[model samples]
Target: METAELEPQVLANRLGVEFYLVRQNNTIGCVITIAALEAHFWLESRASDARILKTFRNGYGRICAIAERKWLARPAATRLELTPADFARR
Candidate 1:
């Protein structure tokens, strides 16, 4: 799959699994595969969220590295269809 231009749903399909990145201290670290991407939205803790706390200490740099790598690997995914809420943008 071409990394870029793939939405979360499409990306999951390409990767053959649902994945979500962890954001801690404003840094995105590693990814965790959940029952579904939205699953993490409802759960307080996520599976595979390890390495995020760096032995329960700090993992900011690690998360930023992973996020940068993954995001750069993907293509530009534009907003295909804006919603009513999006129209609020001023």
Candidate 2:
């Protein structure tokens, strides 16, 4: 897929999540947050790279799985305070 065809915010809206653009060390990436689980997943992709769309798609699937199996397993209150690192250790 082409980068131009992949709009992060559009995907997030389709998934009913929040999307943010982040920059670190001169690199730009997308951070997707699932409000229901308070879970955040980051996907690093260059806007100029055509492969970014594929990367975004894969990351989106991973985040969905993590949110469902890991975050959703906990109580809603616990999920509200959970972080991405918490899922990684599980």
TM-scores, all candidates, are 0.25, 0.31
Among residues 3 or more apart in sequence or in different chains, the pairs in candidate 2 whose N, CA or C atoms overlap within 3 Å are: none
| Regions of candidate 2 where Cα sits further than 4 Å from its true position | 1-54, 75-90
Q: What TM-score does model 2 achieve against the real structure?
A: 0.31
With a 3 Å backbone cut-off (N, CA, C), the pairs that clash in candidate 1 are 4-74, 4-75, 28-63, 29-63
The superposed Cα distance between candidate 2 and the true structure at residue 44, in angstroms, equals 3.9
For candidate 1, the TM-score is 0.25
lDDT per residue (tens digit) for residues 1-90 in model 2: 345433554333333322332223221223343332233333332232233444446566665455444433543322222235745644
**RMSD vs true structure, all candidates:** 16.1, 12.9
lDDT of 1 by residue, 1-90 (tens): 344322232223322122234233232223323332223223224323332222222322432344455555642421122122322225
Question: Residue 1 of model 1: what lDDT?
Answer: 31
Residue 16 in candidate 1, Cα distance off native in Å: 18
